[model samples]
Each structure stands twice: as structure tokens, then as C-alpha cells.
Target: MPDSVLVAYGTTNGSTARIAEAVAEVLRRDGLAVEARPARSVTSVTPYDAVVVGGGLYTGRWHKDARRFVRRHRRALAERPLWLFSSGPLDASASERDIPPVAGVRKAMDRLDARDHVTFGGCLEEGAKGWVARMILRSGKGGDFRDFAAVEAWASRVGAELVGEWERSR
Candidate 1:
């Protein structure tokens, strides 16, 4: 029901950014104004009526930018309609089952009273940074496991809830 929404993401190698964009696209389709931006680049959350925050998980921790963003804007974020998401898990488990938020993200969700949280399959491919990524690629364990259909499906649900809330408020 918010006229404006912010989809902010923290991504390493850009996979999480794409996921954030997909969420923004769905929200826009549902007749809301949405902007998707990197979490580090977002200076404030005050301009938006609602917010969706996402981070790429690394060693069970949310990206630093995401963690900082939440900490920096905790008060504003807590006052708004907020949702959280994580992008990680190189396997299909995220799509197959409910992947709970990592401890840090879970704490943030609780502190902010976020409406919901979801985890999506992560993408790891050629040209990824870090030795671990290289090792994974060399070991032939890397692939694009991101399911856009599933992403869209989840976004549709979020959009519906927001739209429904807006209609009722009117």
C-alpha cells in the first residue's frame, strides 16, 4: 500500500543485486513506486514508505554494508513496513525448503519488527572474486542456482500483501 518502496541490497559479485532488482520489478508491477539500490549507497530510508533489505550471506554473516545499514538506520527502519531477505546457499535447498535467516539477520529482523524474511538461492559462476570462489569453480561446484521463477513468485506474494494493505487502509 505504500506509494514508495526502497529495495536495498548488499551483494558481493552482484548476484544479490539482481535479486533485489527482481523484487523491485514485481513491486513496481503491482502499482507501487520502487527503487532498488546498493545498501552502501543508500544514505537514508526516510523518503520511502516501505523498505526491503537484502544481503548476501558470507560465513553466516550478512554483508557488512547490510549490517551497517540496518544499524545506522534502525530507528527509521523499525518505524516503517520492513521486509528482509538473504541470498546465499549455493545449492537448491533454499528453493526446496524454508531457509531461516542467519543469526545476525534474525536479530535484525526481530529488532526491526520486519514483516517477513526469505532466503533465495545464490549464484556463483566464472569470474567470481576470492580464492574460495576460484576453488569452488575449479572443483566444478559452481553454478547459477538462482531460480527467477521462484524469486518472482515470492515477490508476487509480497506485492499482494502490500497492495492489499494499501487498499484496506484507503
Candidate 2:
């Protein structure tokens, strides 16, 4: 395994970016070199040992830039360990439903043999949304429902895996 990790994310309201930062922090604490950047900022995946892709859901789809990034770098990503995550489902309750993975992401997953895919709770600010999204948020049905503990724990696990891989490569 390589000593570098990249946490690339796409966010609209910025929640997914926070999640990506948290993951990167945990990995950094594990003594690995990690860089977190927006998906659009990543020109290539060639320099990373492993990649973690994250994006927020908008109208049941991931941000377009994220989808495009993955597609463009799918071949390079396939040669490395890859993990995918999404910020969706307003709360833990929403996780119970069988929401299909975003179509573009599903295609990427097939190509990358992604080691893991996760869906975490998302958020929508009161006035930060468009009319339709605002209406949904105003309905009292949506909330900032991220479970930071769960997010941290998952990151720790991934860090452990990266550490193991790094040691073996040595």
C-alpha cells in the first residue's frame, strides 16, 4: 500500500465536505499522510495510495462533478484501494428504506471494486435551499442528522485497514 490517501468530496450545502474532513482527520491521527480536496479540484488520482470519494445527494443524485471525477479516473482508481461514501438520508430513520445507489456511482463501483460504500445522514439549512428543497426542509421532515460518532468510528476502521496495508507493503 502507498503512504498517501486522498479524501475527495463533492458538496452542495457543505455537509459532505465536513464529513470528508472528519474522515481525513481520523486517518491523519493514525499517522498516515492524507489530503482532503473537493472532487472538482482533483485533476487525477495518480498520486494517491488509496482514494475515498464522498458526495452529497441532490434530488436523489450525487453532485455532477463528483460523478464525472470518478468516471474520468476510474481506471487509475481501479488499481488502488477505493472507498465510496454518500451524505444522504436526512436521518437514521431514512436509512431503513431501500434507496438504490446513485446510478453513476453504481457504475463506478462496478469498475473500481470499491472496498466499501456508506450512506450517512445529511443536512439542509433553513434558507439555504431552493424553493423545492426549502419546502422539504420546512416540512419538519429534514434535519442535520449526522452521527459524528459513527462517522469517526468508520474512519478509524478505515485507518486501521490502511495501516495494515502500509505495514505489509513495507
Candidate 3:
């Protein structure tokens, strides 16, 4: 229920950034001040009332920047409300159960007392690669599986709680 939020994300091919932007848009719509930035670019979360950290899951681990962001700001984040997210799993079935597989991040979440962690379906453009991607796109396989509706819905829910918390404090 912070008046402001910082959405820090780490992305490789940029899918994670898009997801973070979508979440930021929803939070802004809810009348909360929000800033979305790449995790590596963020040096501090001092100005924000809440923090949302997310990253792309690659090879059963979160992107390094995102992990480092949490580690660097763990003390500050633990003093405020925090949330975590991971964007990966090109298929619906896989996304439903996709959680970052890192003990360090899990420990970080525990330290921050994170409010929640969500896994969202991701997009891997076949066009992003050369020949293989084109073939996949043509076959309509492994395209963008991200559900914008779901992302917005979850963001809206978080917004409601956050706004309510702010109001109560006021």
C-alpha cells in the first residue's frame, strides 16, 4: 500500500521488459506513482514506497541483474513491501508452473517478506532468430504466449490493495 512503486526487471531479448511495462501501466492507472527500469540501471529503491523485482528465467535461473538488484537492495526492500515475478515458459502449461529455481532468490524473497510472486507466459519471436524462428512463426509454434489480460488483471489486483493501504495510512 505504498504511494509509489519501483518496477525493476532484467531482460535478455526484451520480453521481460514488456511484461514489466504492462504492470507499470496498470499501477499508474491505479493512481500510484510507478517507475519501471532495467534492474541493472537501478542503483537504489530509496525513493519508492514499494518494490517489484522481476527477471527472465534462463537455464533454470533468474537473470543475473535481477538477482543482484535484490541482493543489493535487500535491506531496504525488506523494510518495505516487495513483490517478485518471472517471465518465461513459452507454453501455457509450462508457464502455469514456472518459478525461478534459485535458492538465493528464494532466500531473498524470504528476507524481503515478498507479498507475492507470479510467473507469466512469455514470448519468443521466431522472427527474432534467423531461419529457425521464421519456421516456428510460420508453423504458429512458440509465438508470444504472454497473456496481456492476465498480466493486467494481476496488476490491477495489486493496485487495489496498494491504494487501499495508502488510503488507510492517510
Best prediction by TM-score: 1
For each candidate, the alpha-carbon lDDT, in order, equals 0.92, 0.84, 0.82
- Model 2 is weakest, by summed lDDT over 10 consecutive residues, at 92-101
Tens digits of per-residue lDDT, candidate 1, 1-170, equal: 68799999999899999999999999999899999999999999999999999999877889888999999999999999899999889999998999999999999999999999999989889999888778988998888878889888888888898899989989
lDDT of 3 at 22: 96
99-144 in candidate 3: lDDT tens per residue? 5535656777788899878778777774464564466567776667
Candidate 2 vs candidate 3: which has greater lDDT? Answer: 2
For model 3, the superposed segments whose C-alpha errors exceed 4 Å read: 94-104, 127-141
In candidate 2, position 46 carries an lDDT of 88
TM-score of each: 0.96, 0.90, 0.85
RMSD of 2: 2.0
RMSD of each: 1.0, 2.0, 3.3
Cα error, candidate 1, residue 108 (Å): 0.4
Clashes per candidate, residues 3 or more apart or on different chains = 1, 0, 1
